[model samples]
Target: MDPNEPIESADSTPESTTNKPQVPPIPTDGTPKKKYVRAVGPNLKKLLYVVFALLALLGANSGYLASIIAMQWYTGETFENFFYFCMFLGHVALGLLLIVPFIVFGVIHMRNAAGRRNRRAVNVGYALFAVSVAVLISGLLLVRAGGFDLKAPTVRSTVYWIHVACPLVAGWLYWLHRLAGPRIKWKVGISYGTVVGATIVGMV
Candidate 1:
């Protein structure tokens, strides 16, 4: 009310002027924030088991076919019925149906590894996936090139060899990947045993 006195603003109170903790401003941009949800441990384990089982079956079938081919080449013994049955099982049943789930689960496993920030696992998983994909494509190409026929000219083609070599490389990579993880000694023994067992089973 005094004519010369300074007028106090309503917002100039001590409470208003007191320093409070500054709250971060909420982002207003339209971009959605990324949330890294970890994959479920049990579910991931199940997925891995499924993937490995499928791989084993597929690998065994391929090995059987390869062994038959090698025997025919080395000893001149033909296994037409066995070869046809294996071709049907491997190409039609496993290749068409099981491969889809194999790739899906494999990708899921790789992504899970990436989410866990396991650099080595992610790298190895991705490498294996890529090589497996290459193997699948080459196998399909081999089939198209008449490699399915024992006497077909395409049996001797580069594509057939590529299909063969890709699987060998993939098997090597798989063993390496397994051995690089925990229980190195156990994995090494298992890897060797698996190779030997598969080879023997195929030969028989």
Candidate 2:
């Protein structure tokens, strides 16, 4: 060592090699924290199925009423005028009820229904839903405009054909929906079956 240089102390140590205080890693970037999102779950999906099937049954009942009018026109038969009016009111109420779950389930499944496997089926389903909604609105409007005259050989009104035809096609579309849709629980299946049987029985 040079004579002018200070001697190093025996206790001197480098501070850089000491164990660092481990920092708890934190996200300091400008991105907003992600909120917790509940996943699309089975129970909710099943409930939607139940609601959809029930809506179809209600729609079927409305169509059956239209058939009664058609038959009266065909056979020169007549129904209780007041009874037809009551049925029309019930159909309107059911249509209003159907609208609620349709919107709610559509929103709930928006993110989950993005697969391509059932695209065609889903497309058909959406079309049927639109037609059904149109039928509901038009039927309500026409009935309000005095559309339910149960004359001999049926007057064949626009709303009558719409109500009848849409349901006829929608029946097959519902079958298509089932063929291409996801597999569900037996309970859901049972409920759907029950509603469908009831709808058919009503028509008969």
lDDT of each: 0.67, 0.64
Compared with the true structure, the alpha-carbon lDDT of candidate 2 equals 0.64
Supply candidate 1's per-residue lDDT for 130.
88
Instruction: Note the clash tally of each candidate.
Output: 0, 2
Error of 1 at 201 (Å): 5.5
Instruction: For candidate 2, write residues 10-66 as lDDT tens digits.
Output: 887656645667678777896877654332467667767767666756755665675
- Candidate 1 per-residue lDDT, tens place, 1-204, comes to 898998879868676557776788788997777786554366777866776676666666666676667878999988658655766466546665566766777777666567555567667767877888887776665554444544556654776677668777887777677765655466755785698576757555
Q: Return the lDDT, model 2, position 131.
A: 66
For TM-score, the strongest prediction is 1
- Please identify model 2 stretches exceeding 4 Å from their true place: 1-40, 46-50, 56-60, 143-156, 182-204
Model 1 superposed RMSD (Cα): 9.3
* lDDT (C-alpha) at residue 123 in model 1: 76
